[model samples]
Target: MAADPASLTDRRLLSDDLLATVRGRAAIHDRENSFFADDLADLAGSGYLGAMVPSPLGGAGLTLREAVHEQSRLAGAAPATALAVNMHHVWVGAARYLHERGDDTLDWLLTEAAAGEVFGFGYSEAGNDLVLLGSRTEARPDGAGGFTFHGRKIFTSNSPGWTRLGVMGLDSTTDPDDPRIVHAFITRDAGGFEILDDWDTLGMRASQSCTTVLDGAHAPAERVMRRIAPGPSLDPYVLGIFTSFEVLLASVYTGIADRALALAVETVGRRTSMKSGTTYSQDPDIRRRIASAALAMDGVWLQIDQVAGEIDSEPDGRADRGAGWFRATAGLKVRATETARYVVDEAIRCSGGSTYFNRSELGRLYRDVLAGIFHPSDDESAHALVAQSLLGPVEA
Candidate 1:
């Protein structure tokens, strides 16, 4: 029998609850279309997709740290779900940002999102690398004085099922091209666009990284969320959104490592090692490696908690490299992303031939954990930015 929704909600903190959700849905998701469906439903039913919204909007009003915990736990159980759910949080953040400016669309979207409307990001493009700042998509002013978006976005996660998307593009009329002036619009309706059905990959397959085409899609001015020239209602917490986002991503991978290590321990504890009668977990060398992974996860968790506290305390100030909090977030993101790769690799090796089987949960997790290293914050340019802060700035 399927578990009760209330029972699922009550054990939000229990690892077994999370594992059961992932395990129950894993096989179904292994298919092409159904992979993300069950996970998205779980996200909606559990209220995790709306965890970022404020209480005033009928959400739980969870803090950044609390959101981090939820993302970490959920992502560890199912990486694809984590990726999809995180996008929902991103939408919630976007909605809250616009709502402070009295944007009614955002208000409406946030309300619907709280009721389980999923959102996605449509930014990455085919020709333009995210490292270089430019969007192939252009927003042209229609003869009627409105804007129409045109161009294709690649690697859009949760494409077909997602209810809303934040499409980023450049305005066609800017005299001098400036990267800072990039704009975003929330689009709903699947028409005027095609969803590319080519997301097959080695890891995070359930992310549904499909491509979307926009052919003269009408986007009114009211739909645009201008980053620059904001009014008084713009909350200062807006600046720290990226930091919080990175922290949440870091937490997920760290939790993946934690879960992988636990599984490795359980698997090896009952088996005999080739070199000795004792189990692999009993060996000092294997024990130390597990300990190392555990220590890395613990350290990253503490750093995430610390940075989240700082964001909460400084919700209305300029965030900078000088601020130990921001710097710590950067450092932690770098460490956690890299460490998760190591932890997962070791977990697979420790599990030996068994990890290769599709039936073993660790095999899927091993593939998913590897995805953390290439995520947005894990990009080389991001690390370079952090490093440049320590070094001198480069002049244009």
Candidate 2:
């Protein structure tokens, strides 16, 4: 018989071995701008795709905190692979959150994941700054009880491997004056969706986050999960996505910072200055910079740990929901991304000109860190959310 799918011991062993394998291939994947196909296959086979599902469902039964830590670990080996896999985790985490709250609406999601079905996030739009609050995609009810989506989605990670795509669209057929956004899951076998071959970019190239065009892509009635008014709703599903996505995204970047700092330490300890005949590790300025970066990273890691732990401990998932949780998660995203950018820059500065080469791991990290700025809850949005949380919303 196969090992129990919920075994944390087995999960860790598999992740460790997977990380080792992915780490060696990261540079090559980045250089070629190819997806981490092997990484995805191994993760799926190892039952990692269902890590957030409960043990009874054949998953690892990991809490959000545990899953985020695992993500950070995976990111240290291959940031793109970890980021891509995060989409699947987001869905599973959301399902677990809902299930714990007595809502079994997303139980099917867990079952599908347990059966090795991969899920991808499809909420991003090219110019939609009000993410989740609005959408350019059209969702028309089929009268037969289903819906069809028509529009394009960008930054669809796991595009090449996703068996299901979770998407949202505006449903205005009932009342255009008061349109509502509908969220649903559609399988890859469903016709009318196209994945464009245009994912080349500055960093995280292995993610293969291509653009997707949905021309009347249908989502059956059963898969239509939520329908809510747009613009900062306190719905549980919305909160679940916000909580999981922001935390996991932060974890990925934090892992990048950790790896960059480790590389800096290795370089400084190995390189000797000709004039001083001493390693850079002994240089006071270099030491100070590294110390500062370490301190910043420590702060980010602590915040992630605290927030995730709090959520897990709260049976109702209420301790970290609504405006306060949103503010905290947004702040974490901004801080973690900015900290990673700073750490990677410092690592490059301390390591010398060689780090500027395209093939340099540090260089890839530097570029990859920049992508964080484009993710939701960006610096401006985060600050705005924080300000609104402290003070009232902007006066009419």
Tens digits of per-residue lDDT for model 2, 100-175: 8888989999988989999999999988988988999999999876799999999999899999999999999968
lDDT, candidate 1, 140-175, per-residue tens: 766554566788987787876787777766664744
User: How many backbone clashes does every candidate have?
Assistant: 1, 0
lDDT of each: 0.66, 0.87
lDDT of 2 at 156: 99
Among the numbered candidates, top lDDT falls to: 2
TM-score of each: 0.84, 0.95
Cα displacement (Å) at residue 129, model 1 = 4.3
Residue 72, candidate 1: C-alpha displacement in angstroms: 1.3
Pull out the clashing pairs in model 1.
29-35
Per-model RMSD to reference: 5.1, 3.8
